[model samples]
Target: MLLQVRELKVGYASGADVLRGVDLSVGASSVTGLIGANGAGKSTLLKTICGFLRRRGGAIAFDAADIGKLQPSQLAAHGIAYLMEGHSVFPGLTVEENLILGTWAFRKERARAKQAVERAFELSSVLRAKRKVKAGLLSGGQQRILEMERLTLNDPRLVILDEPSLGLSPKLVHEVFERIAQMKADGAGVLVVDQSARHVCAASDHLYVLRLGEICIEGPAASFSDRIDELVRNFI
Candidate 1:
């Protein structure tokens, strides 16, 4: 497994537990989907795994190393890229510059940086056309794509996405999932959280249905799709 999370528990300063005993894992060759309601702690789990939130208990191991206490910067240096909700980009910077920022740790690797940027451009023509434009000027969907492109430039071993498809048209959402699928195909593990159950199921190799901060059900993506409504009704 590229990432392993076991019996994870976390909460804010108020001491109200948002996540309770969550167990999840992602592999280099797979797309792992986590689906749930608004307050089900799906995002919290991702945040904790990436070091945005401190875990109250349990362990997080990445690439066979215990990394529960690492900071976000350390996690990024260890080959984990986190795409927070809203697909945040450097609003003032040009798309190209934003992508360059993604490779800050690899600033000395000139050749590899160029190759990564080119690969990001290959994901969508909109990016190639507006490479010099300020990221804030792009449409919502376009900004999301740019954010994703920026992460790709980092060449992360594990990519964690939180609501990548939020607030986009159906077609644009499809494009977002398509790009996520391409990530798994490229041999990077993907841990995705999306409000859209159908899209998540479609993109996932393994599916975990989270409810009240716990995994209520889990199985292959195809199995969940076969009986999604029934499972969603019972668990989510």
Candidate 2:
């Protein structure tokens, strides 16, 4: 498994539990979709996996090593990249500068860093066009794509995306999904959380439905879509 979570739990100090014994796994070269309604703890699970949120119990293992105790930066160094929801890029920097910062972990290796930026620009044509423009001036969809490009720069073994389609138009959403498909084809394990069931299910190899802070169902993506309406009515 590229990533694994066993009985994971997380919650705020005074709030009710947000994740209750959540368990999941992502296989190499596979795209997994996580679906849930708003406030269903989908984002919480991603945060825990990326080490941004504390794990109150259970374990998260990446590449067969225990990562539950690793810090967020440590997890990033281990090739675990997370494209967080909303605007994650630096508002003050140009697109190229923002991308260069993405390679901060490899700052000592100037040649590799330059190569990664070149690859990112190649993969995302929008970034190429807006390379000299400040990231804050880009459209929401464009910014999201840039975030994904930044996350993929290091060729992370596992990528976690939170609500990647949230603010995109239909056309842009299709482009994003295509990019995600390409990632899986390149042998990167991907775990994506999104509310668009049709698009997400269509692109994923496997599916996990989360409701009330727990996984309600999981199966092959095709089968999951066939039963999505019924599942949502019962679980969501």
CA RMSD, predictions in order: 1.4, 1.4
Candidate 2's TM-score: 0.95
**Weakest 10 consecutive residues of candidate 1 by summed lDDT:** 227-236
lDDT of 2 by residue, 1-236 (tens): 98999999899885678998999999989999999888889999998888789988889999888988788888667888888877799988999999998898887889999999998888777899999999999999889888888888888878899988997999989988998998898889999998888888899999999988899889999887777778767776
Residues 109-228, model 1: lDDT tens digits: 999888888877876799999999999899998998888888877778899999999999999998889889888888899999998888899889999989998898888999878787
Q: For model 2, what is the alpha-carbon lDDT of residue 9?
A: 85
Where does candidate 1 clash, by residue pair? none
lDDT of 1: 0.88
In order, what lDDT does every prediction score? 0.88, 0.88
